[model samples]
Target: MILIINCGSSSLKYQLYTPDLAQVVASGMIAKIGEPEGYIDHFVGHRGEHHRCPVPNHRAAFALMMEYLQSPEYHVIECPRAITAIGHRAVHGGSVFFGSVLVDDAVMKALHECASYAPLHNPCNIIGIEEAQRMFPGTPNVVVFDTAFHQTIPARAHMYALPYELTQEHGIRRYGFHGTSCRYVSQRAADLLNRPIESLSMVVCHLGNGVTMDAVKGGQSIDTSIGFGTFGGVPMGTRAGDFDPAIIFHLVKDRGMSLEEVEEICYKKSGLLGLSGLSNDMREVSEAAAKGNARCQLAVDVFVYHIRKTIGAYAAAMGGLDALVFTAGIGENSAEIRAKVCEGLGFLGVEIDPRANEIARKGHPNISAISARAATLVVPTDEEKMIAIDTVQLTMAQPGAASVQMGHAPSTHGVAAS
Candidate 1:
């Protein structure tokens, strides 16, 4: 099995996958670390259990989780050593790693250097890697970056309209997030459309709590929405997506708010929660909008308007759109939101069939009319499977791989998911 780990500043999320990368062995998440009592939810096959765990840090959480992995009652692996490889979901690989790589002394150093780009995410990821290496000893470990997929975005699209020297010196350019999900969905979209991914022009809308629109050309990312940080692009759960530098200055000078305070506003107090004067959850906002709540309606309106504007702009940028994809939380569940965004896009040959969209949930495919020129699809992302595929391929390419393969059964082995 190749274990997949995605750690945040205070949470560690993990999945244990059979080496074939086709089926999950187990999955769980631990949250509120560094406290006397945290929470851990573990699932093996179809059964799961939740517990209030006193997880002190990533290391403590790892130790506790390893116990469960070794337990007979719900064990996925007979022993911890049964895990041949560990794949870490590292954010901000910067320009150093274009693809997933085996973690080593040099690679660990590079991950640290890129930490400033994603301070909130990378530190926890690094901690997890260190702990896993110590706990798993000689098992092969790899890092798959969230920023790595967007590395295909060319200079003109990623460059900022600032002094060239300052930009080069500071590495201040667009480095989009949700790349893992974006990459997976674009490939899935191609499959649904029955076309070569390399022969298609498509746009992927990853509209979760954190939203980003990526324009993929010829199976590569040509452009994406989130820039430099997750703090920009389309409005999200709590982030102020698009911001002006002058607004920060004004908030500091006129409102007497500190830069840090302003940053908090940009990060936590804005978006749907701030605009609607309600919760950040889209379901809540949608419910209030249905009840004729004006601010709630405006919040939904702003979101739909951004999607429409982004789709139109990306189509122009990519020459034309052959397919449009919607994935993640809001995109997958909200048929109402999808209809509103696809409206008036008939100019782009996007004709949404209301009935089809309404019944489209739980991983439904096309939601557009059969006569529509552009194909519209809703694909659930499988990031862990992608990570497992990359891990197996990279590890198998190394020396002694045959011996490594012989150590595990066929069920523990996986086909490389390229």
Candidate 2:
């Protein structure tokens, strides 16, 4: 069994995959960690139908996951011994790791050092790693970085127009997020298109509670919508997105709002929730807009406008795009949002068939349209599976890895245990 861990600020999601069986034996999530009313929701099998219970910390949450997976109800395996390796989804690898690596002392230290770039993510991620190390001693752990995949971005695309000293001293530049999703969906798109990924150019849209559009040319990121921080590009659940820096001074100096107060507006008091004066959920926004709520309509409009504009920008960035992919929550399920975003891309040779967009929800091989110059696809992102694949491949490549217990199972794709 391969365990994959994704640690967020207030949540920890995990999945146990039995490669030989080609199934997710167990999966769960702990929500509101560090909060008074934290809870764990664990499920066995592919359906993920299970229970929710109080879980306080990362260690406690992990223990809960382990207990349930090993319980007679789930019956994942006999013990931790059945689990060969652990895979971690690390958010910001900085410029250090261009690919996955077997976690060692040096790699752990590097992850800690890179926490400055991702204050909200890397710290918690490290905590999970440290706890897992203590709990599953000697087990091979692999760190699959979210930013590592985008390390191929060219200097001209990642660099800012700043002083040489500042750029070199601070390491300030564009390092896009949602790279795992982008990598997975792009590869899926390549498969759907029946072409070599290395020979294709595509623009991938990762729209969830957070949004980012990436320009992938010949299987490598050339440019992306996000910047130095994860808080740019299109507006998201709570992020302001593409706001003028000058507005900060105006709020602090003229309006007399404190820095913290101003920061809240940008990070928490904006986006669909703020604009619509309703829920942050796109489904709710769509419902309100359907009821002719003007503010909700405006919020949805602005969101789609930015998505379309970024799609155009990426198209131009990659010279021309061969395909446009939509993934994540909003992109995959919301036919309304998908259609609005692709409304005026005919000039770029992209068009979405209304019926196709509506039917392309759930599962793979959802092609919205193929006749357009650039095919528009809705491919679901599988970051956990990607992490597991990376972990298995990298850990088994090490020196003395021949003895590593890889569960002797086939992966979801029927690949044998490494």
Candidate 3:
């Protein structure tokens, strides 16, 4: 079995895929970890069920997941040994790892060095890796980085126009996040368009609580929004994106606030929630705007405007775009958001069928429309699946059979353990 594990700051999501990968034999999530009321949501049956049990820490939560997977009630596998490999979704690999690798002492050390780039993500990711190593000793494990997919970006694009010394010394470059999602969605879009991925130039919009726009030219990343840290780029749930450094200077020097306080404001007290003075939920913001909430209206407009403007910029960068791909929560689910984003994008020769956009609500293959020049698609993000596939391929002991095994793993033939 191939087990995929995504460890967030306060949650752990796990899924068990049989060697053939036809169905998710077992899947569950442990949310609110480290809190007293935190619980486990265990799912087993074809449709599965939600069971809530106190989960105090990641280790405890993982142990609980193991128990549930082995239990007759869940019956994911006869024993823990049935799980041959573990795939972990590690957020930042910095500039070191251009692809996935088996988690070794060296890899762990490199992850620690890159933790400064993703403060909220890397530490937790490392914790999960260490704990999983403890929980399933001798089990093959791999780390699939979110930044790996975008490593194809050329230096001219990924490098900022900062001092050369600063760039070289601090690793200050645009190592984009959400690369797994971008990779998955873009590949799916290529398949939907019935075009070879290498021949396509596309713009992928990944909008969730966190948002990013990437310009992919001929199957390689040319540019992306987020910079060295998650705090830059377009505004998100609580993050103040792409603000001037002068703002921080004013807050610290003029307002007599500490540097940390200023950072807290930028990272937590801005964005949609701050601008609207309400919830960060886009659906809620849309409703409020419709009800004549001025600030809320401003927030929605700014969000969509940012997306549209960025799309235009990416189109320019790519010289031309063959497809516009949307993924993640809001991009995949909200018809209104998608429509508003494409409103002024006609200059790029892109149009969406309103009816198709609305109906392509969930699941993959949500191709909303196609114009003479460009196609628009709403592909549900599958970062976990991408991570799992990468993990299985990179960590598989047998080299020649890896790709073939992965491509057909969802069928009856199981992965032949090397």
Task: Output the number of the TM-score-best candidate.
Answer: 1
List TM-score per model, in order: 0.94, 0.92, 0.92
Which regions of candidate 2 fall more than 4 Å away from where they truly are?
46-52, 362-370, 400-418
lDDT for model 2: 0.81
Error of 3 at 154 (Å): 2.0
Q: Write the per-residue lDDT of candidate 1 for residues 1-418, one digit (tens) a residue.
A: 8899888888888999887877788899998999877998999988998999788888888987888878788857888789999988888877566667788777888788889888888888899899889989999888888887887777778877788654556767788988888888999899888999998899899998899899999999888999988879889989988878899999999999999999899989888988899988999999999999999999999988988899999999889989989889998888888899999999887887788888777456888898999988888877777778878887888663322211112211111111
Error of 3 at 212 (Å): 1.2
Per-residue lDDT tens digits for candidate 3, residues 192-287, read 888899998899999988998998877777789997788778888788888788888888889999998987877888888989999778889889
**How well is each residue in 236-300 modelled by candidate 2, as lDDT tens digits?**
88787888889999989999999999878887878898899997888999899999999999999
Ranking by TM-score: 1, 3, 2
Stretches of candidate 1 off by over 4 Å are 398-418
Better of 1 and 2 by lDDT: 1
TM-score of 3: 0.92
Best first by lDDT, ranked: 1, 2, 3
> What lDDT would candidate 3 get against the real structure?
0.80
What is each predicted model's overall lDDT from 0 to 1?
0.84, 0.81, 0.80
